[model samples]
Target: MILRSQRPLKLKAAFICDISLETFVSIIKTAYSYFTLLLYIAN
Candidate 1:
């Protein structure tokens, strides 16, 4: 379970390094908001 969760973050980290910091942060924020919305609905 830990590996599963970390795998995406590892991939994202590589991608983030390839892109500009501002865009990478924006992408992370967008994904985080979507995940939060899903959890909100689930709860």
Candidate 2:
């Protein structure tokens, strides 16, 4: 009975984790691009 109640919470957690992972990747990509652009300008 306890496991049944927790099932939805587990799914919600997994969904949130997936979203955070995607956001993290996108942030890193944006930062990387900005860094490269700065380097090019410095040259």
Candidate 3:
């Protein structure tokens, strides 16, 4: 019974990790693009 209850909690934690990772990737991409844009304007 305890094992079954803990299984769902593990799945929830994995799901949250996936979401945060995706968000982090998108933020990095946005920042990189902005950085390039700034360099282009400066040139």
Candidate 4:
């Protein structure tokens, strides 16, 4: 049925969204750590 097919697609989209959000958060954390390290070195 069409509903069954759409269910998988919705799950896939949700998974992709979760992955992208995790990646974005990781990148921000890495950048923040690097910035902090640089500031520490400068001081």
For lDDT, the strongest prediction is 1
lDDT, candidate 1, 1-43, per-residue tens:
8878664442246555455567778998999999999999999
Question: Which clashing pairs does model 3 show?
Answer: none
Q: Which stretches of candidate 2 lie over 4 Å from their true place?
A: 1-19
**What does the lDDT come to for candidate 4?**
0.68
Backbone clash total, candidate 4? 0
lDDT of candidate model 1 versus the reference: 0.73
In order of listing, the candidates' clash counts read 0, 0, 0, 0
Best by TM-score: 1
Model 3 agreement with the true structure over 1-43: per-residue lDDT tens digits: 9888665332234455533455666778999999999999999
Query: Could you list the CA RMSD of all candidates, in the order they appear?
Result: 10.3, 7.8, 8.0, 8.1
The per-residue C-alpha lDDT of model 2 at residue 18 equals: 35
Model 4 lDDT per residue over 1-43, tens place: 9878664332234455534455666778999999999999999
Taking all chains together, each candidate's TM-score versus the true structure is 0.57, 0.56, 0.56, 0.56
In candidate 4 the C-alpha lDDT for residue 37 amounts to 100
What lDDT, from 0 to 1, does candidate 3 have?
A: 0.68
Off by over 4 Å in 4: 1-19
